[model samples]
Target chain A: QKEVEQDPGPLSVPEGAIVSLNCTYSNSAFQYFMWYRQYSRKGPELLMYTYSSGNKEDGRFTAQVDKSSKYISLFIRDSQPSDSATYLCACKINTGTASKLTFGTGTRLQVTL
Target chain B: SAVISQKPSRDICQRGTSLTIQCQVDSQVTMMFWYRQQPGQSLTLIATANQGSEATYESGFVIDKFPISRPNLTFSTLTVSNMSPEDSSIYLCSVDGGSDTQYFGPGTRLTVL
Candidate 1:
């Protein structure tokens, strides 16, 4: 099984609506979690970051991590058309040495007007 | 966040040819990584490029297939050798000094047709 699993969602929602995206993992050793946004032809942009299991809020975006369930979430309030992109959840595992970030299958989001 | 600049933003290469993608960071970092994102798939780690040392490849990835070079702390290169149609994908480079928070580069979109 893959270390991280995320839905490749063509999740469509209307503008001004709230959006919730999630990912689940099997590795209990993961210590850090992050959410990245990517445009059609650009790189993945860092949106939110959380270490351990907690909730971190930045602007209209919130990131939640549940270490007990190995689940992570990204919530966006008041979505916009420009918000349409791919959302990627990454987990970092520090094996007492160099750390590596394991990524999940990105979820494609489309916000309509 | 670091400003990461990648060269040859997009390329169309012929099968059996090799292309080297370059990533440059404005700030020096100790951790550099190379990843491949196939169509509709999650990002798969190719290798970790450590300055002044041979890159460490992940399972199912080899140095021969995707040779990586990190001659310094601010720059790294990943070469896709003997490319095939299956090799066409977006190749991304990321870096993080010690924070689990990683910053990604504007990926190089490669088309092997």
Candidate 2:
């Protein structure tokens, strides 16, 4: 099984709606969770990251992690057309070195007017 | 956050040909990573490059196929040797940001025809 699993969603929503993207993992050693936004033909941009199993808020986005359940979530409030993109969730373990990240199949979100 | 740039933002190469993608960071960093993002798939780590040391590749990746050079802390290069249609993917480089975060560079999109 893949260490991280996310829905490959082409989820479409209206502007000003609330969007929630999620991912699940099976690795208990994962110590950090991150959310990345990737536009077409562009690189993944780190939106937010959280180490503890709680919610971290930045602007209109919120990242939540539940270590016990191995679940991660990103919530976007008042989604806009400019917010249309693929969202990727990544998990990492503290390996005392440059640790690699395990990424999930991104969820593609489109916010329409 | 580190500002990263990649050379040859997009390329079209013939099968069996090789292409080297260069990654440059605004500041010096300790760890640099190479990843492959296939169509509609998640990102898979190719290798980790550390200055003054041999690159450590992940499972299913080999130095002969994706050789990496880390001549300095701010620059690295990854060469895809003898490319094939299956090798067509977006190649990205990332830097290890302290506190378990990573910053990715604008990816190099390669199409092997």
Candidate 3:
């Protein structure tokens, strides 16, 4: 099984709505979690990062991690049309050296007016 | 966050040909990596590029097919050799941002026909 699993969602929502994206993992060794936003034809940009299990809020985006369940989530509040993009969740087993990221199959979100 | 840039943002190459994608970072970093994202799939790590050493590739990825170069701390390159239609994918270069965080560049979209 893949280390990380996420719904390949082409989820459509209207503007000003709340968008929720999630992912699950099987690796209990994973200690670092992150959320990335990718636009069409562009690479992913880091949006939120969390260590271990906790909730982190940045602007309108909130990232939550539950290590016990190996589940993570990202919530976008008051979504806008420009917020439409692919959201990826990545996990890493925090080693001293460069930690390789294991990513999920990204959820595609479209916020329409 | 480290600013990363990639050359030849998008390319259409013929099967059996090769394409080299360059990645440059705004600042020096010791940890750099290469990844591949196939259509509708998660990002898969290709290799880890460490300056002054040969790149370490992940499982299923080989140096012969995707040779990587890390000449210095701030620059790296990934070359897809003898490309085929199955090799068509988005290639990304990322640098570790400490604490398990990575910053990705504007990916190189490759289409091999």
Strongest candidate by TM-score: 2
TM-score of each candidate structure, all chains considered together: 0.96, 0.98, 0.97
Give DockQ: model 2.
Answer: 0.88
Q: Mind giving the per-residue lDDT tens digits that candidate 2 earns over B35-75?
A: 99998899999999999999999999999999999999999
Model 3 TM-score, all chains together: 0.97
- In candidate 2, list every pair of residues with a backbone clash: none
Task: Please tell me which predicted candidate would have the highest lDDT against the true structure.
Answer: 2
Off-target runs (Cα >4 Å) in candidate 2 are none
Query: Residue by residue across A1-113, what tens digits does model 3's lDDT show?
Result: 99999999899999999999999999998988999999998889999999857889999999999988899999999999999999999999877866899999999999999
Q: Compare candidates 1 and 3 on DockQ and give the better one.
A: 3
User: All candidates' lDDT scores?
Assistant: 0.91, 0.96, 0.94
Clashing pairs in 3: none
Ranking by DockQ: 3, 2, 1
TM-score, candidate 1, is 0.96
On the 0 to 100 scale, the lDDT of residue A38 in model 2 is 97
Please state the error at residue A3 of candidate 2 in Å: 0.7
Name the regions of candidate 3 deviating beyond 4 angstroms. Answer: none
Specify the CAPRI tier of model 3.
high
